[model samples]
Target: MKILVINGPNINMLGIREPEIYGRETYDDLIAYIKEETKLLNIKVSFYQSNHEGNLVDKIQESYGKYDGIVINPAAYTHTSVALLDVVKAVGIPTVEVHISDPDSRDEFRKISYIRQACVTTIKGKGFKGYIEAIEYLVKHHS
Candidate 1:
């Protein structure tokens, strides 16, 4: 199986952005972990992180037919990007939303997720392991 992992907004600043809330692991570390995990499952995955919402949306839209499923961490855009949601819906690809921190336990603004409703599942609060978890879950549940 093949998967596209898209990270949006401040995600490029992973380890440096906010250590307390987002954790100390870098996005590259998370990608390495996902790569290892997917290798074990015999799955292929492509990862991309962007601070631009439109670029992320493009990535999601481009995944249609090119990927079997999508795993995304839209960062701050998760609560704000209707464009991303539209692309996800239009692509009709299986998707999983991931977050390093549990937004529900944070400020109210961080708690709202416009993308969750459009995903197959949401994984949060597990740090970088969240991505690994999402990949595993998405692959398992895909027919």
Candidate 2:
């Protein structure tokens, strides 16, 4: 099984953006954690992070028949990008939306997720572990 992990916006600044909410894990640390957790699962996983909305959309488009599932953290775009929602829907990939911090508990704007409507499930507030949960869910359910 193959899974594509996509991170958006300021996610690359994980460690320095907001340590209080997102913890001190660097983006590389997050990737390592996910790799470690899924190492024994025998699933092929790939990762991509971009601050640009079009690049992310292109990645999703490119995932089309190449990936079995997707674990996405749209970050700031989660609340604003309809293009993301549309592309995910168009790709028809089983997607799981993930967040390092719980958007529902944050500001009113954060409570909205434009991509959630296209996802099979959503995981949040679990720190870097949330990516593991999302990947495992995809392997178990979509694979």
Candidate 3:
């Protein structure tokens, strides 16, 4: 199975930005963890991270026929970007939206998600484990 993992905005600042909520793991650590997990599952996974919304939309658009499914953590864009949602919807790939921190439990602004409607499932509050769950879900469901 092939899966595209996309993270946006401040995600690259995971360890430094807010160690309390995002944990003390660096972005590279997160990548390594995901790589290790996917290796065991024998799933081909590609990763992308951009602080720009257009770049993210472009990546999602580009995944259309190349990937079996997508695991996305749109970060700040989750609550604001309709373009991201449109592209994900347009791509029509089975997608799982992941959040390291639970939005519903945070500030009101974090609670609104424009991309959720386009995703097959949304996983939250599970930290880095959320990404693993998303990958597993897509691999199991993407036939």
* Per-candidate clashes, comma-separated: 0, 0, 0
Cα lDDT tens digits, model 1, 60-109, are 88788899989999989988988888889899999999988898898899
Residue 116 miss distance in model 2 (angstroms): 0.6
**Which 10 successive residues of model 2 have the least lDDT summed?**
17-26
Q: Which regions of candidate 2 fall more than 4 Å away from where they truly are?
A: none
Residue 87 of model 1: what lDDT? 88
40-128 per-residue lDDT for model 2 (tens digits)? 99999999999999999999999999999999999999999999999999999999999988999999999999999999999999998
User: In candidate 1, residue 125 scores what lDDT?
Assistant: 93
lDDT string for model 3 (1-143, tens) is: 89999999999998999788889998999999999877889878999999999999999989989999999999999999999999999999999999999999989999999999999999999998999999999888885
Query: What's every prediction's RMSD, in angstroms?
Result: 1.0, 0.6, 0.7
**Which should have the higher TM-score, number 1 or number 2?**
2
Q: How far in Å is the alpha carbon of 42 misplaced in model 1?
A: 0.8
Say which candidate scores most in lDDT: 2
Better of 1 and 3 by TM-score: 3
Candidate No. with top TM-score: 2
